[model samples]
Target: MIAIKGVSTITVAGLFAEVGDLSNYRDPRQIIKLAGLNLQMNQSGYFKGQTTITKRGRRRLRSLLYQVARPLSIHNEGFKELHHYYKNRANNPLTGKQSYVALSRKLIKIFFVIGTRNCSFDETRMLRDIPQLKPLQEVA
Candidate 1:
């Protein structure tokens, strides 16, 4: 896999080293769970509490992803746009930090695709596929 924007060589190596082989995982969601990035909902009967991460997997992996996400959202054009979209969406806008967390999860999925398929990252495809991320002019 090639180096993604804002992803350093060390970060990429660390990620690959942490993951080892991607064959065992059935899907990207599995990797997300492995990183403890899977959402956990605190809902019981009629009481629905906040949704948060499980935090039950590799702590170093989760921390590394978050560390990368913050800079990725600031330095990478695609990631930056996505981060802004996530934080400003109408339905349920996330805080800046929350958006970065979400981005970290997204990065996991991206890495999964890259590792499994041996394909390079496609920023334009990502931006295009998420229709909700279209500019305000188009939405309006």
Candidate 2:
């Protein structure tokens, strides 16, 4: 149902349909949030800090997904590029939450690719897909 509504093509949807239910996760967003990818908030008496993730999502799920992100960032060229891009931003620094948010968004798209395309995750292809991610040229 969600896949059909998602932006993927029919071939992609068909591919995912074949994979069938992945574990017990029915909602992708819920799964992503559970992975501690969702935004959070922090507040004090007078000064309120930037919003942050509560890390209250599913512990196992979040750890597992983040685990994947770590290696991918190292071994996968595309993810590595993304990591560098995030790490080098000068004006707008990407906090840990921001970095994971980027990774989580990519993960969601990759999940669809894996589920529907019947293809294993490809680091090069992911990088090609997200060309806007430029390598960090300089650090501030």
Candidate 3:
């Protein structure tokens, strides 16, 4: 976490404190849902309402992640690209706020991976899943 440009030691510590052990989570999405960063559909009957975050979990975790998101978007190259991709994608683009929420969720997933794997952060790994953002390799 500290290796990420925008994340400080205190922020990482706060995250661990709020989320407890990441191993308890079988999937990172569980932690995303726990932080209330997961999206929820607000629909009833035949009326299809807007989708929004549930905001149903630990408030501190949500706020902490959001707080971490601002700097990550500005200072972290991978996250900056992701935010741009989210906002500028041709299909169903997200607004700036939505992108931030997405970033926060991404951070949670990254934290989960690193915490469980006991490895350092890797920018290429972070963005590898997104087809549009694959890192280019040098030709021999």
Candidate 4:
């Protein structure tokens, strides 16, 4: 987790303390739901309510992730760019708070990947999906 910019040793410790062990989780979505960052909505065909985070799990984990997101948005290159994309995307743009929530969930996924794969964070891989945000290619 510390491999991710803006994440410190203490933050990693806190996350682990709250989440127990990452190996227990078979998928990142499990952690996302554990943090209560998974999306949920009320729908009955005739009426569809606004979608929002389930906010149903460990409160400390959710709070910790949310707190980490602000600095990640400012200091982490990949996270910063992703945050901008979330806010400025052409379809259903998110407000600032909503963007932060999304970033928090993303952070959980990053933590899970790094924990499982034992790999360092890669900024390029994080942004390659968005054509406009993808880094420019070098001239051969």
Candidate 5:
């Protein structure tokens, strides 16, 4: 595991440490599928039911990412914006499961950025990079 010095949150850094070399994964879509974010559908001829996650991969990784998202949504402005963006702007608003999937994917991207740059999480940079998520103006 490559040590990323200067990460503000020890817990997040620790999680990244456990993730080992992200470059080994190459494709983030594979990670998302491994985290059970890929949807599965059940259909019978003309009757097709709703689609659902396969739930057949790294449960622990998925659990950890979901756990992290909870506090981040409350305390991190960028995550708050992301949460609101997904909840409000999605064509089909995400349920809790889908929201976690989205968050997990976002976390993986953030982890990659931090790991590669050897820098701490920057809320402002994240908001600027992901323009789809507009920051909320603070009430005076």
Candidate 6:
């Protein structure tokens, strides 16, 4: 098992400082909410508006995740593949920024797993989580 590469030390330390103990979170989704990275709906009666992040939590933590997202998408093979899949998938493909936000959420999840479970990062498992990425794996 390899250490999770490409994640900066400062970012992880900063995230831990903001989030305290990962045990406090029931799951990664909870961590995502804490970072205000969760998707929010804007629906009033039948008029549904554009969905966006809530941006209601620690600003620094949120910003850090967002900042790491771009580099992670480029330098990390798993993240890069996931980023491409998010942008090009057949159903409701995300725009560039949207994909980054999604990647940020994913980073939060990975961080949560690391902090709470004390497990090494698994690239194969990470890619397996998203079915859309599977075929791309075989091709590449």
When summed lDDT is taken over every stretch of 10 residues in candidate 1, the lowest stretch is: 131-140
Which residue runs does candidate 6 get wrong by more than 4 Å?
Answer: none
Which digits, one per residue and each the tens of the lDDT, describe model 4 over residues 91-112?
9899998999988887888888
Q: Write the per-residue lDDT of candidate 3 for residues 86-113, one digit (tens) a residue.
A: 9999999999899999999999989988
Total backbone collisions for each predicted model: 0, 5, 0, 0, 0, 0
Q: Model 1: clashing residue pairs?
A: none
- Model 4, position 118, has a per-residue lDDT of 90
3 or 6, which is superior by lDDT?
3
Tens-digit lDDT track of model 1 for 54-132? 8989999999999999999988888888998998889899998789889998899888888888999887766886777
Query: Clashing residue pairs in candidate 5, if any?
Result: none
- Give the TM-scores of the predictions, in the order they appear: 0.90, 0.59, 0.93, 0.91, 0.70, 0.92
Across residues 1-140, which tens digit of lDDT does each residue of candidate 2 receive?
22322223543344244334555555566556655667766777987888776676566555545555666566656666777777676757686646756775577667745654567665555665544442432231
Candidate 5 wrongly placed segments (more than 4 Å): 1-18, 117-120, 128-140
**Whole-model alpha-carbon lDDT for candidate 5:** 0.66
Candidate 1 residues lying further than 4 Å off, grouped into runs, are 135-140
Give the per-residue lDDT digits (tens) of candidate 5, residues 1-140: 13322223655655555566766676666667777767789789998999877777777767777777776676766677777777787477776657756766777777776666678766666666554453443321
Candidate 6 lDDT over 3-44, as tens digits, reads: 566777787788888889888889898878888888889899
- Candidate 1 Cα lDDT to native: 0.85
- Worst lDDT window (10 residues) for model 5? 1-10
Off by over 4 Å in 4: 135-140
